[model samples]
Target: MLTKFSVTAAAEKFMRRVVRFSGLPSSAGFRLLVRTGGCSGYDAEFSAEVEARTGDETIEVHGLRIFLPAESRVLLDGLKIDFIETPDRSGFAFIKDDQRSVVAVSADVARIDVSAIGRG
Candidate 1:
């Protein structure tokens, strides 16, 4: 169990939509691999997979199955996942309580600096 990880409502909805449209079976799960990178010390890549990979821990959150490898599980602990959208981009952001760091993951970009984001 991931006791310290939390997913915001927006993030949960986003994840559900991704799985629903992934063209995989209903039992498919979202596989998230996280590592240390980006400005916030969190870099993530995700995809819909038919099943959890070997050694992956499957977690059910609000009916959505998420697959996390060992590294991801540790990195995601104590972090909150949220979805953020702007006119120019939309993606998932991992945040901690102090809000000092954020890692953005999107289809078109690998990393984004949260400090540089502003209404334009």
Candidate 2:
């Protein structure tokens, strides 16, 4: 389980839009999977899912239901998630509580991970 996980307002808003427009049922939640990748400590893939996958734990940040796998839960411990959008790009940025972005996953590359590949 995560010892600490936080999301900024912008990140929350972004997630809400994703869920609301995902075309899934109203009960659908955002599924986030993170792994070690590249120079940064993390790489992430996310999607709106109708429900948590097997072995996933559902956590609520405010009202958004987030589905996280075991590895992701450990990776997200003590991190804060934020959303950043600019003229050139938009994506979710992961930051340690006392540092800058550890990794930024591009929205353009975000995809559904039904296969659970590369997890852990």
Candidate 3:
């Protein structure tokens, strides 16, 4: 089966740190899922799991197991997972392997459409 996403070496190291700090067992793995609602219309969610759930596709990179749900396969194809640390923030980030920016709109611009938003 084709790989839907990739985990960077830095990400692997970060996962190891997380596992060590969280007291997760050696068998622990990460699950990546796609959910609606983000600047680009979708978001990648991560969770720690002890074992693969039904319909999950497991991919191991350098002995680290990363699980992807069958439903999220298409949305996450060609994705690159990395760990970034900065003075202000430090965490995992998902980037498109194709190099496209995740934020579809410019940060300086505000897009608001009254017609598109309906009141319940």
Candidate 4:
């Protein structure tokens, strides 16, 4: 029912790549969900969906249909989905517009502190 989230051009481009890589139908879109228990208070989930479910709010961008379930509407509002690529990492990120923070649910790289290894 609520429509507050948006998808960036980079995200749309990434989605298309996902579809091609996964061999999903062109009509398929992404479903955004939120769940508890993560480094942060909540975690964002993404899945490729062929059709929208009942009670789902659909946001269309560049011929892509991004579906948000009713339950996740509140938690995901005012967020922007984007695809970022750096020399060391690349993946999807959820940008919290209001908080000015980025939450990455899936990324190719992880941070490590070599100095902290085997130290007490």
Candidate No. with top TM-score? 2
Per-residue lDDT tens digits of candidate 2, residues 1-120? 544789999989988777777767778898888888844556777888889999899999887999999888888888898887888767778887777645555454446444433223
Alpha-carbon lDDT of model 1 = 0.74
For residue 30, give model 4's deviation from the true position in Å. Answer: 1.5
What TM-score does each of the candidates earn? 0.77, 0.80, 0.66, 0.68
Query: How would the candidate models be sorted by TM-score, starting from the highest?
Result: 2, 1, 4, 3
List, residue by residue over 23-94, the lDDT tens digit for candidate 1.
667788877788877655566777777899998999899779999999989888888888888888777787
Q: Give candidate 2 misplaced runs (Cα > 4 Å).
A: 100-120
- lDDT of model number 3: 0.62
Count of clashing residue pairs in every prediction: 0, 0, 0, 0
Candidate 3 residue 40 C-alpha distance from true site, Å: 5.3
Off by over 4 Å in 1: 1-3, 98-120
Model 4, TM vs. native: 0.68
Better of 1 and 4 by TM-score: 1
